[model samples]
Target: MGKVTTGASMSIDGYIAGPEESGFDLLFQWYGNGDVELPTGHPDMTFKTTKASAEYWRSLIENTGALVVGRHLYDFTKAWGGRHPMDVTTVVLTHNPPADRPLADENFVFVTDGIEAAVAKAKEIAGDKNVGLNGGQIARQALDAGLVDEIGVDLVPVLLGAGTPFFPSLGVKPVQLEGPISLIEGKAVTHLTYRVKK
Candidate 1:
């Protein structure tokens, strides 16, 4: 089995998305922004070193075998046009599955049970590859449940005064994190990786 990882890009103030109902365009502007090249031979490298930050992001998506996302996120992105950007199997957590019963294909699966079931299914589908937990709420649940092995955050310089936080409180005990396995400083955002201390 492989590790369960979660990642997101948040503002300097730690907001993942803008105020309630506000879109995430500004928070995710780095996606469409120009490329960011990093220096060679960084000591704290985790994954394969890349010349450009965009390439690093692409590599992450490519490496992930399966993904778990919340219902809100799934609906917000319009199911990524019925196909995920990474083109990998994705499991969506929701209390209400579609009326069509199993509305999934080789690309997506909707889990109505809970986050644990979703993660289990994702791990099964992922096999030896990594299972990516996307978005804030779902990531929080995974962390609270001790299902995530690593956390990576792309810290953007901008600060959305009022917005959704990247790591919301789960009302559970604090979770400790270890060494930033990697730190890629980019023109738009800085990527930092931390292993969840088990």
Candidate 2:
């Protein structure tokens, strides 16, 4: 019994990343860069300050046990050179398996086919900690299959006019909010936890 968390920095318009994103440069631009803080005036909500954003990100990352991501993300991690905090047990979801992956360590394992297989493998490996659904597509798969129990979404303060949509196409389902926690430092970072009504 573990929670499935989906964490992403979305625009005010609800886009997760910019268009044609083979890799997560958009993710790096928003989460990686700490220089320019996301502006606070969002039509949907405001991120009170930058410190709040950092605190929120840290909190989410700290809770994640294992990661389930697409092959694209795995390749992106490889291109960015070796070793990342996400270098723990990762199950890459893809149709075609890679001939050779840079991460050959015992921690990294590739899962071809679908999210259920990936999730089952991750849970088997991750004993006690929670599982993190790495991307929008993967999240959709988990949500559709009723694998995810909870989600942690970080509402950043910028709107990328066009980018990856946070919530992709999926069948209707009920999700009830547990409670909202706010980390107020520079800005206000809110973690809205949701329980998927199964």
Candidate 3:
């Protein structure tokens, strides 16, 4: 059994994306700032990051077997040009599966039922590896549903004044979280992880 994690890169102001999705260049600077080359499923999207970030990114990719993302992100990336950057299976949690998609494949799976089902299917696919949840909407719903075991963040230095938050408003406050379990400092970014208190 693997853990379910909410992993994202957020600004100092705690936003995953800036207002109108304007500050991506600032938030994703670390992905291109270092000498280490990290390849992705996309032939054109390799990451150049510092040794620390490179190590962290590698570990992330190694442990993450699948992802649960919302429909918004699925459509936003145009289905990541047919596969996600991590090169792992991605489970999309949506209201409706895309009309043209096969709904199940080596690269993608569409779960239209709900977040719980999405997580379960992701976990099944993940096997012994971790399941990563993407986007604020998906993360929030999983957090509220107690499906998230860990929270991972690559904290960037910039502050996106206003934008989509990493975690949207929940039904309750101060949901207890245990130790930051791990923290690694990378160039222009700080990788942090906290375990959710059961």
Candidate 4:
């Protein structure tokens, strides 16, 4: 069986996005500041990262077969211009799906149920690969339900004084994790992974 995981690019002070959706320039500098070229499904989207980060990204792409994202994130990027850059099937946990894409297509799946249902749908699509949960809310819900298997954090140097935090409040506080099972240093980012200790 595949694992369920979530990850984010966070600042030193633990913000995934800055206030008013700002600070992206500082948060994502590593994405374009490196020599290694990593291409995405979007023609215009490509990542230039250090060799280590490139390897990490490649591994993520290989292991992640599907994703579960919240509606807020879906709307934020305008559904990533009709498709997610990862080129994988995405399940959106939304109260109401968008009008244009009313049905499930190659690009997206809409789940009106709760987070568990959304994760289940993504798992069904993922098969032997991992199901990546996107956004802080989704992760917190899954963590509260004890569904997540691992957590990955790409730690950057800068701190956003106020903004969306990477790890949101979990009802289950003091959750235990085992091992920084994997760690790598990239250009201005340190990638860390921890297994959720149930």
Top lDDT prediction, candidate number: 3
lDDT of each: 0.79, 0.62, 0.91, 0.90
Query: lDDT-based ranking, best first?
Result: 3, 4, 1, 2
lDDT of 4 by residue, 1-198 (tens): 799999998988988999999988887888888899999977789999989999999999999999999999999888888778888999999998888886598899999989999999999999999999875899999999999999998899997998988668879989999989999999899999999999
lDDT of each residue in 1-198, candidate 3, tens digit only:
999999888998999999997888988899999999999988878999999999999999999989999989989889999889999999988888888989899989999889999999999999999999985889899988989999998899997889999889986567888878999999999999999988
TM-score of each: 0.87, 0.74, 0.97, 0.97
Residue by residue across 75-152, what tens digits does model 2's lDDT show? 865722433354356777888777766433555677875889889887876667778886578887888888887766
Query: Which residue runs does candidate 3 get wrong by more than 4 Å?
Result: none
Candidate achieving higher lDDT, 1 or 3: 3
Please estimate how well model 3 matches the true structure, expressed as its whole-model Cα lDDT: 0.91
Q: Cα miss at 117, model 4 (Å)?
A: 0.2
State in Å the error of residue 109, model 3. Answer: 0.7
Q: Name the better of 1 and 4 by lDDT.
A: 4
Off by more than 4 A, model 1: 21-23, 35-51
Instruction: In candidate 2, list every pair of residues with a backbone clash.
Output: 48-187, 48-188, 49-186, 49-187, 49-188, 50-187, 52-187
Would you list the clashing residue pairs of candidate 3? none
Kindly give the stretch of ten consecutive residues in candidate 2 with the minimal lDDT sum. Answer: 40-49
Q: Report clash pairs, candidate 4.
A: none
